[model samples]
Target: MKLYWSSRSPFVRKVMVFAHECGLAERIVCVRTVVAMTKPNVDLLPVNPTGKIPTLLLDDGSALYDSAVICEYLDSLHGGPRLFPESGPARWTALRRHALGNNLTDNLMLWRNETLRPQPQQSPEILAAFELKVRNAVAALEHEAAALAADPVSIGHVAIACALGYIDFRFAALDWRTGHDRIARWYETFARRPSMVLTAHVDQ
Candidate 1:
């Protein structure tokens, strides 16, 4: 399997962490790829029309894009720890957390793009609304962290950790830790994991 990704992408990091946690890290070959929302890399266009990073090229020649789908596929292979639960309530909880994490990341990405735009082109109203979503997402994560004392290492947790890491990487000035100390603490510990340390950050 060939995994094309950008080291700094939170979504890509989620798949990497999941691969390590599932003990399948060595099975896939990691290929560094560049992808920009405005102008994506030409190399990726041939494989995926969306030209997104974290695209998985299977040995059989099938390709899978999107980090969530890739991570789920990797999880199914080993069945080692079961990143996504097999049954009812637990599965729903994990999926909900995972969705929340993804949504948080989505808003963060939007906030970042808006910031990159010229000051005159940026919409203050849109930025303000996205900032509020980010804040609410952090609060939601703080509540979730309070319940994860066991450090279950589910798909949701991995995604959430990556989301927090992205904030640290790009929006460090944002100071998300002010009132959401619990989530910050959770991330502090989570970020120290071996997988995270290995694929920490990459400069563009």
Candidate 2:
């Protein structure tokens, strides 16, 4: 398997973290690919029309994009407790947390793009809205951190951690730990996981 990867992408980190947990990290060959929303990378166009990173080129000659799908696929290949529960309430909870995490990350990334735009083209209103959204999301996580911290490690946990990591990497000025004490404390330990320690995001 081949993965079009970017060290700076949290989405890519999710997949890599999943791979590491599943003990399949050594099997995939990572091909570094630079990509930006406004500036597309031609090399990725042939394989993934969206020119996205973390695109998986499977050995069977097929491809899979999106961290959610790729992580589930990798989880399926493993034998231990599934990152994605196969059914019932556990499945729903995992999916819900995972979605919330992804959504939080999406808004943050968009907020970041807005900041990168020329000052004249940037929308202060949009940035403010997302900043509020992130604050509320972190507040909600503070309530759930105690439970999430005591886990067998679900894919949802992976998503949430990656989302938080992205904030620290790009929006450090936000200081997300302000009042979300439990979540902050939990993250202090979660961030030390070998998978996270190894795949820590890098700007360049």
**TM-score for model 1?**
0.95
Residues 2-25 of candidate 1: C-alpha lDDT, one tens digit per residue: 999777788888899889888899
lDDT of each: 0.86, 0.91
lDDT of 2 by residue, 1-204 (tens): 999998999999999998988888999998889999999999889889878878999999989998898999999888888989888887887898899889999999999999999999988899899999999999999998988887668888889999999999999999999988999998888899998998999888
RMSD of 1: 1.2
Counting clashing residue pairs in each candidate, in order, gives: 0, 0
lDDT for 152 in candidate 1 is: 73
Candidate 1 structure lDDT: 0.86
Clashing residue pairs, candidate 2?
none
In candidate 1, which residue pairs get closer than 3 Å at backbone N, Cα or C atoms, i.e. clash?
none
Error of 2 at 105 (Å): 0.8
Q: How far out, in Å, is residue 189 in model 2?
A: 1.2
